[model samples]
Target chain A: AQTVTQSQPEMSVQEAETVTLSCTYDTSESDYYLFWYKQPPSRQMILVIRQEAYKQQNATENRFSVNFQKAAKSFSLKISDSQLGDAAMYFCAYPSITQGGSEKLVFGKGTKLTVNP
Target chain B: GAGVSQSPSNKVTEKGKDVELRCDPISGHTALYWYRQSLGQGLEFLIYFQGNSAPDKSGLPSDRFSAERTGGSVSTLTIQRTQQEDSAVYLCASSLGVLGEETQYFGPGTRLLVL
Candidate 1:
């Protein structure tokens, strides 16, 4: 099976500063994709960034980026120029194919991000 | 374009009663998924549907939990004899269901509170 792990339960960053949340995953598939999702107090989950395992370049989206280390099985998200609105629960996920041939996302426990003014 | 939508933004129910959560996926998307998020268990997949057919229901926690998608667009998740542990935010997502187009767009989840 596949599993995602976020070692840090919480992280804080000053506004305009940068913060990085750690994520590690285990999967036997050689080709896959990684995603970061943000869930705020409103309970709406928004896609933050995505990284393709086949690509050597790290994925970035405006202020959000990822440091994906394929060898170490690590995919960490970096939030630069952090703003108060960036405060949310961030989850790292990857797709896994079930025995019945359907794909499902396996998610990490999540890291709560707090942006301090 | 409208994103994935879920009905009943919040629900409160008794322990033994049943509850139904609804989801409307993005238009033309062939794959829909159900997931649950709770304090105890971060996030878990519940089921996956492709074009109104469920190829995988393995993520369902128990027999009491069941889901179905119809018209290949809307889906409903039903919990029979709801329990306290079933209290969580139920999320729905949809994608094109084709390889290399697997980015799933999520909806604002339905928060289900079981008393």
Candidate 2:
């Protein structure tokens, strides 16, 4: 079974600083995709960034970036120059293929981020 | 273009009553999915529809939970005999259904509270 794990239940960072949310996963499939989603108080799941397993280059989207280590099976999210708006729940997800051949996102418990000014 | 949208942004119901949640995916999206977020379970996939056919109902918690998508655009999830444990934020998402391009756009979600 493929499983995603976010060990940190909560994390805090000072505004304008950098914070890295940890995520690890175990999957037997050689080809897959990993994603980081942000859920604010509005309850909307917004896609922050995504990384393909086949790619060696890390994915970066403006202030958001990922440190993906395929051999270690670790994928962590880094928020640079974090702002008050960056405070939200961060979830690491792995799209795993089921036995029936459909894909479903397996998500971690999530890390609640607090950006303190 | 509008993103995925869900009706009844918030619903309050008593236990044992049936509730229906609706989702309107992005126009032209062939794949739709339903997910649940609760305090205990965090987030879980309930079901997904590929152009009105659901090949993956494996994530549904029980028989009480069911979903259907018609015309490849609108989808509805019905929970029979709601339980307090069923209280959670239900989210809907849509994708192009193209292989290797799995980015999904999500709705704001419907917060369901069962009393």
Interface RMSD of each: 1.9, 2.0
Best by DockQ: 1
Poorest stretch of ten by lDDT in candidate 2 chain B? B97-106
Q: What is the lDDT of residue B10 in candidate 1?
A: 95
Per-residue accuracy of model 2 over B1-115 as CA lDDT, tens digit each: 9999999999999999999999999999998889999973457988988875655888889999998887778999999999999999999999997434668988999999999
Model 2, residue A70: displacement in angstroms? 0.6
Separate DockQ for every predicted complex = 0.63, 0.59
lDDT computed for candidate 2: 0.90
Q: What is the C-alpha lDDT of each candidate?
A: 0.89, 0.90
Q: How well is candidate 1 docked (DockQ)?
A: 0.63
lDDT of 1 by residue, A1-117 (tens): 778999999999999999999999998888888989898988877889988899999998999999999999999999999999999999998887766677788889999999999
Would you list the clashing residue pairs of candidate 2?
A: none
List the pairs of residues colliding in candidate 1.
Answer: none
Superposed by TM-score, candidate 1 places the C-alpha of residue B93 at a distance from the truth, in angstroms, of 0.7
